[model samples]
Target chain A: MMIPLESFHLAEPVLAYLDPGTGSIILQAVVGIVLGAVFAIRMFWSRICMTVSGIFGKGGMEKDGEDETEHSG
Target chain B: MRRSTPAERRLPSSFRDPSGFLFQRDGTLFRQVNEVYREDFQRLMRPDGLYDRLVSDRLLVRHEEAPKEFVDPELGFTVIAPERVPFISYPYEWSFSQLKDAALLTLQIQRLAMEHDMSLKDCSAYNIQFLEGRPVLIDTLSLERYEEGKPWVAYRQFCQHFLAPLALMSYQDVRLSQLLRVYIDGVPLDLASKLLPSRTKWKFSLLTHLHLHAGSQKRHADDAATGKSAKARDAKISKFRLTALVDNLQSTVRKLEWKPAGTEWGDYYADTNYDDQSMAKKQELVARLAAKAKPQSVWDLGANNGHFSRIAAEAAGVAAVAFDIDPVAVEKNYRQIQSDQRKDILPLVLDLTNPSPSLGWHHRERDSLAERGPADLVMGLALIHHLAISNNLPFDHLARFFHDVGKSVILEFVPKSDSQVRKLLATREDIFPDYHEEGFEASFGQWFEIEERISIEGSERTLYFLRRKD
Candidate 1:
């Protein structure tokens, strides 16, 4: 899943922040965890399942042709 | 197969991953949030009062949730349409105070996120926009739950995006803020580090925020791609510490103040070529012409301190865009606007010779100055002489350019006989022999119909009201 982020068209003012310089790390970690978990789960689980489903549905004949070509070669 | 429509012609903002792109449907604005963002979206809306609090505080835009159906085939997310902002301005377009306000607003939002055990992953200024003179954060999904001790991931981005440019503008030159236009992902820290003076290293905030920050960035630059993601997950920051950090940033930013210095045309009225009566007559003539035009919107092309812009604004109740090449003049005009709380005028720094052009991805993202539009009426007071004599642009070209910008033009012609034009001509070639009244009328007549001409009592300058023909 994606995190909502704002995009500014032009440059922003260089005013001070409400948070200290050091405290930004905590926020970054929280964001990293949420985004990381979602991406990992999708790539490893749903992606494999989708590939397996596609093979069973349409690619079985293609797989047999490939195996025949390999044996002939 | 579903047939496609013209509504899907434009692309959304290309920076972030999980969040969908912003698109316009039938002139209404909407954002598409992917299923990838669903978990974070749920967390932001579920427990911490983050969404409601920000919306109630006016820190966020209030929106009606969009339906689940897909408008396009490629994207995984559906639309979550939001309210449209009236006029969007860029950082380069903002006055010093406007930018300062935006920075402070971003920090405020970040702090609130921390209080709710959420944190902002990215601190790009583009995510923030001004609504009715106040800065508001637009990117709702940028906030995620804070993890312990992994180091601020968006730290370098914050410094580059907000701190670097601000420091450069504050310490080096105010005009340096334009550097943001060239650096899309904010000014590069290495470049910012180089441009800043040696003395900046001595300042504590500048040292930690810019110099040392640059050093750390350089060291970890490549490591960011492969570094331990899980290490970041285990660390957490306290709420009180976050507030303290906010206080530190506020104080640091507050300390970085810039004093406006005088520039050419900033003190123009005070050091004019005209005597008091002549000045009064000029003002009277300008006011009369402005009233006659009856413009709903006026652009004072070379508005020096906005003296005539005020006349048009006050007389016609028109919204005026007062533009000048001089930041000093624009700064002074901004101060005036702030003092009076005048909602009708916007003063901007613009070099007429080389106006802002279309910049960013595919040269289509941020529009050029001309692309913004043709003002209803345009004024070229004391500007033609500079363009004609100094810049060497022909009177015909000048007239043609003005014709394209405004339907009606109230232009001031300073004759070759005039001291200012003479002084300009004395310095160089007077190829503009057609720079006289006869020549002006002849060249301009091709594009415009001369409506009226009034001469100021004690000055040689003449103001002409011309409506574009054809």
Candidate 2:
């Protein structure tokens, strides 16, 4: 499981002054933990899940719903 | 605090970021890096550093270290001169695509910063500028060294500044982009959440980043109000997670698209009243006037896909701003600029009746259009009737506005006999009895000297070139 930022510790202090917002920090921390755990599980268990699901006649790993886009031509 | 020398004047918008402030000395802009920003500034300026990489990728503005004498002896750590954009445009003034592109650019920079072991200290729409038809980050001091287990500091600002406005524009009315003018720090997420359609909540990205995000802000409002920084500050989001967060935002911005169609003036020229001879003649007349005017900059008020502004742009090495009321028309102009690879023209969405005003702290954070220019020339073709007849504006009001924003104007006066004017009057009673050529000359002549007047060959419309009176 990914560590939530609230409980995560940093050795260095951030130099910027703008508030990152208390709610935003907590929400993103939750999101980050979920996404990281999902990616980790997918990476580690892809083959096992794919084979097991295939044997059961179910769908395997779905494609990552991401496409690359360029900023400047 | 180090005092500005007699020659150095600090720009108002430059005061927010404390790493440095942009000031002008002898009309040339320079960023004065404070002593506290020495390490980050050095890292950026070092060879093969983040600055070099970003500049090479055209993600950020390139700058040169100013002469030693240019640096202030007191508070200035050092000074660097950044390359100037032809024109600076605000997020409120941007087209849907332009704003979307800027959002993507900010995310792109953030991802790249992660790879470089740095983070954007702030994410603001004002920091991004449209340069040569592309959005580039102009603030060189925005990057800070990324600390392990530290969350992205600009996440809230990013959502507010880009995602909120974009979502409202796409899911609601495009004119809702005007909300950027009211909320200068980007649209409030709670407000955005309320205004957005219920259908948008079905979208996973919007649901998390916007709806839930606003809810989170509410949940933590009291904590923030009580100054409970210890709890949030101690919370550490790992670098990997932050990277994932940025990646998701990038995908979200990409998926949010606004197609330019169905707007009133999007396809305006397709069914214009001007026939081939009259259109060509009008073009010739504008070209002749522009050539004689020889302005370095032009503002094409009511510029429809920039057909007339192109004359002035081609005649002189001019930086032209094309202002139109229709978002689709401005989008078409922007897309054309991209496809054509033209750099001189900037297309923006603006309502002439309610132009952008002074905003932010002291009403100086963002400039009004008139404050930004007194453009060398203003080309207002086939636009008088809309302002005069449709909007019920008087000739003197039009003249004074033009005088305030430009040194000269190329105005076209369409007679009441014109079909477009007749169509406008058909809906309402013709209360504008003074809407005649003689009255136009008389009211405008109070502020401007009529330099030239030519009637189109095939139509009854008259074109006048007037220079502002000294």
DockQ winner = 2
Flag regions of model 1 displaced more than 4 Å: A1-73, B1-4, B7-18, B38-70, B73-87, B116-118, B128-153, B224-236, B260-269, B273-297, B314-318
Candidate 2 lDDT over residue span B1-470, tens digit each:
56678888888888877787888999999888887787777656667878888999888999988875534566668888999987889999999889988999899888888887788989999999988778899999999877788888899999999999999999888888999998988899999999999999999889999999999999888895687756887788998888878888888888887764554434555767788998888888888888788898899999978877777788766778999998878887887887788888899998999888888889988988888899899989999999999899999999999999989899999999988899999989989989999999999999999998899889989999999997
Candidate No. with top TM-score? 2
What local distance difference test score does each model get?
Answer: 0.69, 0.85
The per-residue C-alpha lDDT of model 1 at residue B116 equals 72
Model 1 agreement with the true structure over B227-327: per-residue lDDT tens digits: 64334334564454444444455556656766565534235446677899988888887888788788877889999778889888777777788888877
Computed on C-alpha atoms, the DockQ of candidate 2 is 0.39
